[model samples]
Target chain A: MNRRLIQWIAVALGAAIVLHVAIVWAIPRVIMSVAMKRIGGEGSVNAFMHTPRTTHEFRAVVRPSPDLAYSICVLDLSDGPVVIEVPASDPYTSLALYSAITDNYFVRNNRQDGGLAEGETIRIVVAAPGAMPADVPEGYEAVTAPTEKGLALVRRVIENDEAMPRLDALRKFSVCARAS
Target chain B: MNRYLYWASALVAGAALAAVSIAWAMTALQGEYRSGPWYTSAVFGSVDADMYTRARVAMFGLLALDRRETMYYTAATDSEGNALSGDCTYRIEGGDLAAHWWSITAYDAASFLIENEQRVYSFSQTTTEREPDGSFVIRVSADPQEKNWLPVKRGESFDMTARFYNPEASIYADPSAAVLPVIVKEGCK
Candidate 1:
């Protein structure tokens, strides 16, 4: 009630308000934003974001329910269009994409035998029902040609030190176009 | 002097109250403490659960009681079914507890449910056929078909996990101490 006492009380209240605002509101928001940005900004990569690493194996999978059988084959051709037979499907569908389930990136490291180096181009023709999803690595050309039943996927891999093994392995697997 | 004493008393009271309030706020903020293999399989990596990656921490295992415990087991695999950096051995043992439900299941690297004809992954008190002694045996191996078997496939990387819900106080107090089942390798075919 005294004038001096009232002024002192007012000053103390103002100081407390300032401290609370600085510590609770401003500080936590700023810290959280920085942390979130660091976790999610450019150059940040989760396991899903990286190119899928695969081993040498012809993988085939059928979903738990009777739907379609998904199979992957890796093959290499010496010097011709690889011959493939399409399987018949009951209620026809399309070929989705050729990608590693993990990173969804094309398996690189394809090459022709007999010491063929980089800058050598190979042509491929795929025949199927719908669009064939092709995932070529960076700086490569992979085009899909549509077929009556499915889609044709064709891609050329230029092998250097990095892509030699993967590309060569992929060239070995020529997925036989088939329907289920 | 009286005024100074009054002001000091008020300040002391405020400090005490603030300390107690801060303690209360912290306790409130630490909401709903839980332990064990809590999984929300709805999300990728089941990220919503507390995935303990700390060194020296024991990863929780789970069992599905619907199947024979002997029919379910796994070889360790990477998150992607790719090979992990190392090889580890594990087993499952059962224990007597006051809980209403419990079981263990095995998963492969892909995390997609493993395929088996019977669809039994592990045994629980509810589903397992008990012995006369009230004890049970569940097999963990690549070939668990002899009886009470859990199957492990060759070149297949997998994980064995167990889950116990509505557990009695004794089991909750010492889960690791519970009589977990034995893990055996029938041999690689």
Candidate 2:
């Protein structure tokens, strides 16, 4: 009610307003930065999975250069089937999908280990969920890749669609044939 | 009376403004999780029931959330250590299921892969083949055979997730299982 009391109240109100602004503006940035530090990049708690290598080295020739960083590896682990390993390639960078490589004998529900028989040629392609072509090799339905989890793959071509031919064509560029 | 009214009005206005600002901030945060033009949340729930079920099955909760448990999601296991499935995809690549292993996988909010041209997904484990000193490499591209691969398909947005199974207990006392990394490669034209 008095002049001094009123002056004190005004100061308190101004301080409260400043405090409110600081809380609103600065808190989120601080929280996010801390969170990011914990889960910010490769090996962060928030990553889908750490790949075997930092960059993907595709043995095949890319088409018009797909949109993303990639490394190509074409080495024959053995003188056996040519197995193609696919990654989870999605336009959406946030959602991480589980993937796998498989031979053409496994069922859609059942899974098989990836010790391919000698001389078998397996084409491995990676894409986001539902991105896999329907035309997979016969006997080989998609199974989760062993190295990576929750992904599916096929050993044989079940669908005789155009994707198989296109993939075959691409395989020509992937002649590195060694796992090392 | 006029003075009292002015003071009261100012106080009320300030409180209301603060409340509105806080509400706006919260709403903006929620926007980050919204679906795109082709899908509504309800529709996403319905259309991605299978994927949703899988995530639930994997993490044993809605949205693969378990605040009390490990930070990175851990898959459900039976007393005997068998990983079950609710149609969600997951694989064990390298980490020692018992100790020192790491994995990377993909899933959306609904726990399914966004539609795309390739169906293949790959995750390599810590025990996955590595260079001489135990350091390893993974390939993340449409073509996995090129070497180490982590796939990212085309969609408006999605999540790439990693899991460290039985990580080196010393990394952090409260290590998270779901470690995420920004895998966006610029200039993919």
For all candidates, the clash counts are 56, 127
lDDT of 2 at B111: 40
Worst 10 residues of 1 chain B by lDDT: B54-63
Instruction: Tell me how far the alpha carbon of residue B175 in candidate 2 is from the true structure, in angstroms, after superposition.
Output: 4.4
Candidate topping lDDT: 1
Prediction 2 TM-score vs. true: 0.27
Can you list each candidate's DockQ? 0.01, 0.03
Instruction: State the lDDT of candidate 2 residue by residue for A1-180, as single tens digits.
Output: 798557546755665576457555544334323323332233322112222211223211111012212222311112222234332221111111221111111111011243333223334433233334555556433423222222121112112223334333332332222212
Q: What is the DockQ score of candidate 2, to 2 decimals?
A: 0.03
Worst 10 residues of 1 chain A by lDDT: A58-67
For candidate 1, the share of real interface contacts preserved is: 0.00
